[model samples]
Target: MILTYAKTLMFLLMSYAMAETEVGENDLNEVSDQVYGVKINKCCELNEIMVDSVCRLAELLNQSMWEPQFKTEDGIAAALKYFNYVTGVPDCATTQQRPIFDLGKSEDELNLLTDGRLQHLIHHLHSSDQIKDDPLITNTYSIHEAIAIPEVKEPSSYIHDQAKYCMDKIIITSSNITGQYALVCVPEVIINWKETSFLMKKILNPLFHAIAMVLYLLVAIIYFVIPTLRDLAGNIITTINICLIVSQAADLVRIFTELSNHVSFMVTDIILYISLLGAFFWLNSFGFYIWKTFKSRNVFLRVTDVRKYCYYSSVVWFAVGVMAAMAICAHFLLDSGSNPYKKMRLSNTIILEDIEQETIGWLGIAVFFTPVAFTIIFNLFFYVTTLKVIKRINIYGRIHYKLKGCFDLFLQIFLIMTTAWLFLLLSWLNFDGLFYAHIVVNLLQAILIFYVCVVRQSHVTFLLRKSCCYAEPIPTGEWGDEMTHMNGGNY
Candidate 1:
């Protein structure tokens, strides 16, 4: 009786172990199905689907109490152990075969069949050609045979082929799984090329602009200290540089702070528009100054009226400010949501749409871009007229033998205006190559100003050299008079 009772207990334990193994197999199948569904629904690439499915299955195993007797610390290790046990094969770490199913074989036979290789299968169930030709063998054989069979033609090809039928099967199963939890377990999606391009622009814009600001600030200080550099044109250039610096600085701040608050966003927007308007006005001023200097043949304006220039510039600045303000107000009024200026974050792509639909948006865009466009056109006209006037004066011998100098002046004005216009043009076109070119040219604005206003002007260069060499400072009036005469009264 004692021996019989002991035997009965042993039999019961064996039955329980078998039952647990079967339950573990069922659990793994369910997990695999969920992972396959996630892959299909997301429409992942071939290799991505494999990696994602494996990772997802591991995640599911970790979350559930599947195979409690396996005694592994985490899901990935548990999965690896489970694969080893089911295949009756040791350390199948790199094997690509389907998950193990019951084969009604002894451990020795199973080991022989798998060649003791532990398989971690990523089956491309969509490839119909990989299935066996015999209907009975195809329907009854393990899914692992598609990958494991030595006779299978091009295993890699089979793995890469789209899993259409499997995808459909998984999709059908997904509807019953609440919340589709397997998706959460997959690895984070990799950023595509489009997102990478935007990210690069975001990072580089602020960094390059900040460097430009420092250069501009240094040039501004030089203008203040060097007496010969202090002139109407110099002052205008300095102001333009300052405005650009402010605008770019505000943009940098907005990028970092994410334009989180309405007040911050509005302040940044207003400052940006105002500064941009100022830059356009300054460019126009420079163009007009060149035209006026060449046409009237005087370094100083013949009328000696600076107030008119100031008035015109102020009108432009204020008009743009008001328009920008109205646009902001309209955005708030029309959006009726948490973040009105959220669209502005992707301003290049969506600003046109805003202008078409929103009243103030159109007005604001018109006020800003219209002035810029007109400035380019007017500058071109001024440049051509100035060139004609200079040529006529040279032929008549009214201006001294400085035809080369006059030509250089024309070239400088043309280049400055053209470069500025190109930036706006490229921005509007939104081509990757053109956009990057715009950034390069835009950042060089300060250096260009320094070179044109300080380095190129003989009087300023003389003063800069003298100051650097610790020589006595030249009288401002003497240098100014000399430069006036050198340009034939057209500095």
Candidate 2:
């Protein structure tokens, strides 16, 4: 939906320029003289609009309002209006038709116009090849030039707000037309929006999430279908898959909601928070179970599987609930106006600064990563402890094939999930280069789980009978069998 609207806006801009050419009308010199105090008869033609002037009006000056409006539809709509006015959208009074003084006379109208003007302005600059990578100038170089220009000094106060605060810069060369140095402006939200949309938001996100949901359902069905496979490990894996399904579903829903511009921010965020955190806790439980199994001298310390599952469920769900509650409280307590998912990602790592708390960055880290950090640390400990226990057992006798297999499966899951999340954290930390890696790894999670649990499991092979001939029964025991000799039958 965004892409289509953008294309239509560009078409209208070009059509307007073409129509002006037919009528032999020129507003460039007038706009440049009035807005930037520069006299120019001609400049680089972009829909008959000067690139340098647009840079100043769209980006350099719009920095103050960009943060508060960029995440919401009101800001996006306001941006289109401002762009139409500046670009001479049809019926919008131009300097030729009406006095320049008539242009933003009312404070309230200017306030409304200023909210989202940056979005469309950045779009035009990018389309004109004036921002991202131009042969004559770059965004960083443009900022320095803009700072030096006398005309830009009046609005220089907002220049300090850079990419970290969700803004980008574009270099504007004006020497050829104005007999003066070039100017610049940085673009943040719009550029990031396009890049993220292409990478995962608009296309890849829904595709991967849909595929993952299907895979999760398939694996779950197989787990429930095969009676012998419904052991403790199977139950844990099944629960994790279910949580993942929920997470993916929520993500898909969010993508649509954002595109339609009717977002229920609080509801979607809560669902995502609970489901994603729930998946992590369930994964942590898998690690914990393995470590406890190795450390125990007897099978599950003689505890029934039902009771054990109940205990695990309680702990995992409670942790998820606690994280959700903390996030909800932070939303209301810290900055009610802030939308942490501004960057179109799940984590609330990026947000505008609030006067009292400095910014919601601290709140995001505290509410989200604090529990995640602890979970990752504990999972690592469990993995290490399990390995040590295996080494000690190896010193005495060979480990059981089933136990070893379980360890391998759990380790694969742990590594995949850990690596994906680590890259996700790095991406959120402004590691622009690692975003592609993060996307690839994150999308492969469901595939990895299916491969490890369904395709490679001996019990699965036994149930499917794809590997053996004549449906002959394989002698592989169930995962819940007591390893009496290995650890005194306390499995």
- Displacement of the residue 231 alpha carbon in candidate 1, Å: 2.2
lDDT of 2 by residue, 1-491 (tens): 99999999999999999998866544665554446541111112222322343434433333321212222224344322212112222121111110000011111111122332212111111122222243233311222221223333232222211111112222235422221221212212222344453456456767877898998888887766555556677788788888878877876775543232234545665676577788788988888887787787753243225778899999888877877777777856774443343322212221111101011334644686677778889988888888888887743322344456667888898887777668767765556467656656667888888888888765575455632455544233333322322332212
Which runs in model 1 stand beyond 4 Å of their true positions? 1-199, 257-263, 297-363, 395-414, 417-421, 424-435, 478-491
Q: Write the per-residue lDDT of candidate 1 for residues 204-269, one digit (tens) a residue.
A: 767777887887787667766666445445555566677777877875665443223223555675
TM-score of 1: 0.48
Per-candidate count of clashing residue pairs (backbone under 3 Å): 3, 15
TM-score of each: 0.48, 0.53
Worst 10 residues of 2 by lDDT: 94-103
Question: What global local distance difference test value does model 1 have?
Answer: 0.46
- Identify the runs in model 2 with alpha carbons over 4 angstroms from their true place: 1-200, 257-261, 300-304, 335-365, 394-401, 429-433, 466-491
